[model samples]
Target: MSTFLTLLRRDCAQLLLGGRRGGALLPVLFFLAVAMLYPFAVGPDAPLLARTGGGVIWVAALLAAILPLDRLIEPDLELGLFDQFALRGISEEGVVAVRVLAHWLSFGPPLMLAALPASALVGIDGAQLRLIEWGLLAGTPGLAALGVLVAAITAGLRGGAALGGLLVIPLAVPLLVFGAGSLSAGGEAGLALTGAVSLVLLAITPFAGAAAIKSSRG
Candidate 1:
C-alpha cells in the first residue's frame, strides 16, 4: 500500500512536471472544441443536437484518450526513464500502473470538462449529461490502460502509431459500444448499469496491461 502510494506520487510528480513543459493540455482541449463544431455544423435543430451530443462526446473522448499515449510513453522510454523506474526498486507492474493512472488523470478530466459545454450546446438534459459523464469516467480509464500497453509495445517500432492503433481499437470497441449505446436509451438504471460495465472494463485494463508489461520487461 505504501509502495503504491509512493509510486503514484512519483508518477504524479512526473506528469505535473511535464505539464510545465507545455503542449500537454492542448490536444484534449482541441478535441473538445472540434467536437462542439459538429452540432453547429449540423445546424440548430434541438432534436438532432440532443440525439448526437452523447455519441459525439463519447467518440471525442476515445480519440482524446488515444492522442496522448504515443507521446506519453515514447519520451520516457527514449530517455531511459522507464528503465530507470525498473531499476529503482519499483515493480515493473507498479511502474506501468502508475503511468496509466497519470495519463488518465492528465487527459480524462479536461476532456470531461470540455464535454460539458458541448453537451449543453447539443441540448443534452441533466440526466443525459450525468450519463455522458458517467460513461466517460468509466470508459476513458480502460482506454488509457490499453494506450499504455500499446504505447510500450510500439515504443521503438517503426510505424508505431499505426501498430498501437490497431492493437487498441479492438479493445476499445466494447467501450464505444456500451458507452454510446447506453446514452440513447430511456431507462436510467439500465443506462447506469451499462455504464458500470464500461467502468469495470476500464478498471480491469490496468491489471492486464501491467502483467503484460511485466512479462515483456522480463
Candidate 2:
C-alpha cells in the first residue's frame, strides 16, 4: 500500500509538476485554444455555437488527452524503471494502475475547471454546461486509461508518439459520441453509456497495459 502510494505520488509529480514530460498546462491551453478559435472559425452564429459547443469541447478534450501520451510509459521504459519495479516485486499491472490514476489527476480535473471558461467561449447554456461537466467527469478516466494503454503498446516503436495519437482517435470514438451526445435534448442516456464505457476501459487497461509492456520488453 505504501509502495503504491509512493509510485502514485512520483508519477503525479512527473506528469502534473512538469518534470521533463511537460506539465498539465499544455493540454489545458490547447483545450482553451480550441474553444477560443472555434468561435472565429464557425463565424459568430450564437445559436450554432451553442448547439455545437459541447461536441467541440468533447473533441478538444480528446485531443488534449493525446498531448501527454508519448510521455506516459515511454520515458519510464527507456530508463528501465519497469525493471527496477520488477526487482522490487511490483507487477506491471500495479504500476499501470497507479499511472492511470496519476495521469487522470494530472489532466482531468483541470480540464473540468477549464471547461467553465471554455463553455462560455463556445456559447453553451448553463444546463448544457452541467451535462458537459458530468460527462467529462465520467469519461476522462477512460481517456486516461486509453492513453496509458496506447503509450505502453507503442513505447518502443519508431514514431510511437504519432502512432499513439492516431490510435487514440479511432479508439476513443465511443467516448466522444456518448460524451457529446449527452448534451442534446433527451440524451441523458448518453451519459450513462459514456460512464459504462469508461468503466469497461478502466477494467481492461491495467492488464492490457501490463501485457503490452511485457511484450515490448521481450
Candidate 3:
C-alpha cells in the first residue's frame, strides 16, 4: 500500500506537475481552442451552435485526450523507469493502474472545468451545459484509460505518435457515440451506457497496458 502511494505520487508529479509538459494545462487550452474556433467557422447561427456545440465539445475532449498520448508511456520506457519498478517488485499492472489514475487526474478534471467556458462559447444553455459536463464525467475515464492503452502499445515504435492518434480514433467511437449521443437525447440512459463503457475500459487497462509494455520490450 505504501509503495503504491509512493508510485502514485511519483506518477502524478511526472504527469501532472512536471510544468509545461504534463501540468495538464496544455490539453485544456487545446480543447478550448477547438471550441473557440468551431463557433467562428460555423458562423454565429446561435441555434446551430447550440444544437451542435455539445457534440463539438465531445470531439474536442476526445482530441485533447490524444494530445498527451505519446508522452504517457514513452518517457518512462525510455528512461528505463519501468525496469526499476520491476526490480522493486512493482508489477507492470500496478504501474499501469497508477498511471491510469494519474493520467485521468491530470487532464480529466481540468477538461471538465474548461468545458464551462467552452459551453458559453458554443451557445449551450445552462441545462445543456450540465448535460455535457455529466457526459464528460462519465466518459473521460474511458478516454484516459484508452490513451494509456495506446501509449503503452505505441511507446517505442517508429512514428508511434501518429500511429497512436490514428489508432485512438476508431477505438474512441463507442465513447463518442454514447457520450456525445447523450446530449441530443437529454436522457440519463446514454450517460449510464457511457459510464459502463468507461468502467470496462478502466477494468481492462491495467492488464492490457501491462501486456503491451511487455510486448514492446520484446
Per residue, candidate 2 scores C-alpha lDDT tens digits across 1-218 of: 99999999899999999776578999999999999999999999999999999999999999999999999999899999999998999999999999999999999999999999999998898999999999999999999999999999999999999999999999999999999998989999999999999999999999999999989889
lDDT of 3 at 11: 83
TM-score of 3: 0.97
Off by over 4 Å in 3: 20-22
Q: Number of clashing pairs, model 2?
A: 0
TM-scores for the candidates: 0.82, 0.99, 0.97
Cand. 2 Cα-lDDT: 0.96
Those runs of model 1 whose alpha carbons end farther than 4 Å from true positions after fitting are: 1-6, 13-17, 20-24, 187-218
* Each candidate's clash count: 0, 0, 0
CA lDDT scores, all candidates in order: 0.71, 0.96, 0.92
Task: Give Cα distance to truth, residue 206, candidate 3, Å.
Answer: 0.2
Question: Which lDDT tens digits does candidate 1 get at residues 1-218?
Answer: 78778877766665544545443476567676767788769998889888887888877777766766666566766677656767877666667777788877777777778778878767899989988887777677777777887787777678887788777778777778877877877544545555565566556655665555555455
Model 2 off-target regions past 4 Å? none
Error of 1 at 184 (Å): 1.3
Please write out the lDDT profile of model 3 over residues 1-218, one tens digit for every residue: 99989989988987888655757888999999999999889998999999999999999999999998988999889999888887888899998999999999999999999999999999999988888889999999999999999999999999999999999999999999999988886556899999999999999999999999888778
